[model samples]
Target chain A: MNETGRPQELPMSNPRADRVRDVAKLAGRPARLKRGRFLAEGPQAVREALVLHRERTAAGESGVVHEVFASESCLDRLPELAELADGVALRLANDDVLAAMADTVNPQGIVAVCSFVDVSLESVLDAGPRLIAVMCQVRDPGNAGTVLRAADAAGADAVVLTASSVDIYNPKAVRSTAGSLFHLPVVLGADIGELVAGCKERGIGILAADGYGTLNLDKLQDENAARRLGASAASSAYALEAPTAWLFGNEAQGLSDSELALADHRVAVPVYGSAESLNLGTAATVCLYASARSQQAS
Target chain B: MNETGRPQELPMSNPRADRVRDVAKLAGRPARLKRGRFLAEGPQAVREALVLHRERTAAGESGVVHEVFASESCLDRLPELAELADGVALRLANDDVLAAMADTVNPQGIVAVCSFVDVSLESVLDAGPRLIAVMCQVRDPGNAGTVLRAADAAGADAVVLTASSVDIYNPKAVRSTAGSLFHLPVVLGADIGELVAGCKERGIGILAADGYGTLNLDKLQDENAARRLGASAASSAYALEAPTAWLFGNEAQGLSDSELALADHRVAVPVYGSAESLNLGTAATVCLYASARSQQAS
Candidate 1:
C-alpha cells in the first residue's frame, strides 16, 4: 500500500486491455445493468464519486465508487484524490487508456467505475424530502441531466425519474449532471402515481410545470410572497413556498391531461414574449428555483 | 406561382446537387460570411424564418429568408409556408436532398437560407431596449443559442454577443434556440466596452451574472418586491426591475475581473444547495426570468 494506504498500482499502458474494454462497456445501459456499475467520466464526476465513496464508507455505508482510472496529469492536478485513494481502488493509466475507457470524446483525464447510485422511491419519500423534482417520461438525456443538476443546485431533497423517463445511468446524462449526480439522491424508474401518492402523504404539494396550465407561475410567486408577509391566508393549494415536488413532463408532448390531473396545480411559467415556450431544462430550473426561493424566504 | 400563390417546383432528387452542397456549406462560418447567409434547419426554424421574412418584407425591411427547401411531407404539414412562397423562393426537394443540406442528422425535412439577421450594436442600442442579454467570450454555440432563447422568452428587446463569443450563426447554436433566433434582435461581434458604454448612455444598468458576486439575486428580488409594494425606495442600483442588460461570461472561466468591473452590479444567483453552480443556459434563464417577473410586477 502507498502512504495513503491505497493499494500500489502499476500504470496501465495498453488502451485495448481487458480492463479498459470492461470499463468502456459501462457506457451502455445493458452493460451497466449486467455489470451493476456505470462509468462516471471526466475529472469532476470521478472526483465527486470518489469523495462520496469515501464519505459513505466512513459512515459504514456501501461505497458507490469501485475503481478510478486517471491519467498522470489528472492525478497531478487533483492531489485531493490521493487521500481518497485509501478507500477506493486508484489506478494510473496512460492518456490513451483513459480515453479508451471514457464515453466522451474528451474525458478530461479521469474516469471512475461507480455502482448504481439510484435510491428507492420509498427511501427518498421516507426521508421527508421538502423539495423534489419528478421527471415524467422525459426522453432526452441532456434534459434529464440538466434537470438533475438544476434540482441539486436548488437544494432539492431528491430527484424522481418516472419509469418512462430516460435512464439516469446513460453516459451522456451522467456527464451532463457535472457532479450533481453524486451530490444528491436520484430515484429512477419510480411509478409516477406512487411517487405522487408518497409526496401527498408527506404533505408535499405536487406542482406540474406545463406551458398551457391555468395557474400562472408569476401569480403563484406573488401569492407566495403575500402569504409569507401574512397579508393573505394560507388557503391556496398552489403556494410556491410549500414543501413541493415539481412534476415536469416530456420534452415534445408535455404532460398529458391525466398526468396534469395528478398534481395539486398545473403551473405555467409566464411567457412574456412571442417565443413558444422555454425548453424542458430551462423551465424546470425556473420552477425549481422559484420553490427554492419561496421556501428559503418563508 | 402555384394555385396557392406558392412557387411551383420540381423536386430535386439528387443529394449531390450543387444547390444542396451550397446550402450545406452555410454550416461553416467562412462560407456563411462569404454568402452573407446562414442555414436555418428543421421545420420549426424554417417556418419561423418564413414568417419573419414575410413580416419584414411587409414592413419594407430587408427580407430575412431568401429561400426555403422542404420535403413534400414538410410542405404538406405546414401549409402556411405556402403563403410565404410569394415573398420567398420555395423549392421542393427529396428527403435525401434535404438531409444533405442540413447540419443535423435529421433535419426534420426542411431548411431555410436566411440572410444574416444579426443587427449592428448601434442599431440594437438605438432601439432603447429594456431587458437584454450580453454574452462575453461564450465559446459554446449551444450556450450562446440557449442564452438567446432565454433572453427572447424574457421579453428582452435584444441580445448582444461580444466579439470574442461563439458564432451565433453556428448550426448547433441555431438549433438550440428552437426558433427564438427569429423572434428578437440579436447583435453579434460587438465590442464589450462600446456595448457597455452604449447601455449606460441609454439608461440601461448592466448586471454581471457571476457565482461569486456579492449582490445576492434573492435579495435583489426581495428589494424589487419591496419596491413594488411601495415599502422601499427604488434607488438601489441592483434593482431587478430596471432596464438592464445581463452580462454572462464564458462556460468554463466565467467573467474576468475586468469584465465584472464594467457591470454596474455583479449579481450572484443564490445557490441553495451544494451543487457548485448552475450551467450557463439555466443561469441565464433564471437571471432573465427574475428581471421579467420584477418588471411585470412593478
Candidate 2:
C-alpha cells in the first residue's frame, strides 16, 4: 500500500498467474493446512474477514485476513469492504482473476485469504464458556457450516469439531457459514473425551442430541420453564439454564454409543410426526436455541 | 385365470425401452405434470410410497404408487420393500435400469412411481389442522424439503407451497423430505391471499416468520408457558397454542412485503448472537416446534 492506503499494483488480469493459482490453491485442504490459510469467498465472507482483520490489527494482534482479491465492480458495489480492508493487502483483480482465485464460480467478485481461524481447545475452555456446540464425526461440509452458523446465532461461546469431523476450512463449508465463520472462535481436531472432561470440570453440562434418547427435549424445556415460573417442585433431570456443551453428531449416524455415554444426559428433540429423525443441522439449531433461550431468560 | 395377487409380468430388464424412458421422464416437471406421477427413489422413500399405497388401496381409495421397480439385490437386501409392493406392479430390473430411470446417479436400487399426492388447501383446512407450514417463493428444492421434513417432525397437520415456489415434486425436494412428504397432507400451488382468508374463516391463525418483526419467538413461547402455568395476564399479541399456519418465506429475501402483510402477525426468531438471521429451514423448524410444544402442552 502507498502512503494514501491505496493499492500500489495494477489490477491483476491474468487468471493463470502464479499468484492467482496460489490463492486458488487455498481451496484444497492440503494447501490450506500447509499455509495455515483458507479462502473466504463472496462479499459477506470477505467483508467479515476484513472486519475481523481490521479489529485484530487495531487491537495490536495478528490479523485474520491475509490478503483480499476483488474485481473493480465488486469494490464499486460494496465500498465498505474496501474501507474495512484498510491496512490489509487489498488488491484489485479482474473478474477472470477473481473467479480463478475463488472456489465458487461467482465468488460474488471478492475472495479473501484468511489465516486459519481455529484456536486451541484449551484456549476456548479457558474462556469459561457458558454454551458450546461440538460436532462429532460430521462429514458433510454444508451440514457442518449450517450447524456452525446456527451455533453462532444461538450465542454459543465457541464451536468445536472433532478430529473425525469435516474440515471447516473447506471452501464449501466457509460459504455455508454465511459469515458466521468469522463471528465465533472455532476449535478443530478436538477429542470428544477431553472436551467432555473439560466441560465436566467447568460445571458445564453435556447433552447428546440423540433420536432414541430417553429424555424428551420438550419435557426438559417445560421443566425449565416451570422452574422459571416458580412452579411446584418437579423432579428435574437436567437444568437447561446451566452452563452447557451440546454434542451434535454426524449427518447420517448420530452420536455413537460411546459419544452418547460421554454426555451428562441424552436428550431427544421430540419428533412429533413420522420423520425417522431430525436432520443434523436442524436438530443442532433446535438444541442450541432451546439452551440459549433458557439461559438467556434466566 | 391366476387368482394369486402378484405381478403377472416378468422382470423388466431393458433400460432403453419406451416404458423405461417413460418412467425416467417423471424426473422432469413437464412429464410429471402430464402423467401426474413422480419418482420415489431409494428404499426409504419407495418404502414409504409403498406403505402409503397399501394403506390407500385398502381404504377403498386409489393407491398412490403406480408402479414399483427394483433390482434383485435391493429386494434381497430389503425384503420388507418387496412385501410392501405386494399388490403393486413390482418389476425387477438391473442396476443399469434403475440408474437410468432415476435422477440420482445411484437410486439405492429401488424406485417407485407415485401419483401426485397434493390435496386442495380447502381440504387441508377442512381437516382442522392445528399447525400448517406454508412456504412462500421458497425456490430451492432442498430448502423446501428441509422445511417440509421439519414440519412433519413437529407434527404439523399440513404443509403448503405457494404457486411461486419450487415444485416440491422435484426429485431433490422429495428426497430432502426424507419420506415426510408422504406422512401428512400437502397443498401445492396455493394462493397466499386465499389461504389467509380461508384460514381466518376457519379460525386458524397465520404467523409469518420475519426477521425484522417486533414479536420475539422466545418471549411468545415463554408467555405461552406462563399462561399454561397460570401466570397473570401478559398481553400476548398472539397465542402460539392456537390453531395456526406458519408462513416461511424465500430463503434469500425472506417473506415478501405482500406475503408478510397477509399474516396476522410477523414473528421473529431471536438471533442471540452475530448471525444476521437464521436460515429458512432452521427458522421454520424453530417456529413449528415452538408451536407444537405449546399446543401439545396445553
Considering every candidate listed, which one attains the maximal TM-score?
1
Tell me the tens digit of each residue's lDDT in model 2 across A51-97: 77877788998889988888777877887788788877889899999
The TM-score, computed over Cα atoms with residue i paired to residue i, of candidate 1 is 0.97
DockQ of each: 0.79, 0.85
- Candidate maximizing DockQ: 2
TM-score of chain A of 2: 0.97
**lDDT, candidate 1, B1-298, per-residue tens:** 7777555668899999887899999989999989999999987888788888878989999999888888878778877777665667788888899889999989988889999998889988898788999999999998888888888888988999988899989999999999999999989889999999999899999999999988989888887877676665756657788899999999999998889999998999988987898999999999999999998888
The whole-model C-alpha lDDT of candidate 1 against the native structure comes to: 0.88
* Deviation from native of the Cα of residue B166 in model 1, angstroms: 1.0
Candidate 1 chain B worst ten-residue window by lDDT: B228-237
Q: Write the per-residue lDDT of candidate 1 for residues A39-94, one digit (tens) a residue.
A: 89987888788878878888998999988887777777877776776667788888
Candidate 1: list runs displaced more than 4 Å: A4-8, A231-237, B232-237
Worst 10 residues of 2 chain B by lDDT: B1-10
| Structural similarity to truth (TM-score) of each candidate | 0.97, 0.96
**Candidate 2 global CA lDDT score:** 0.91
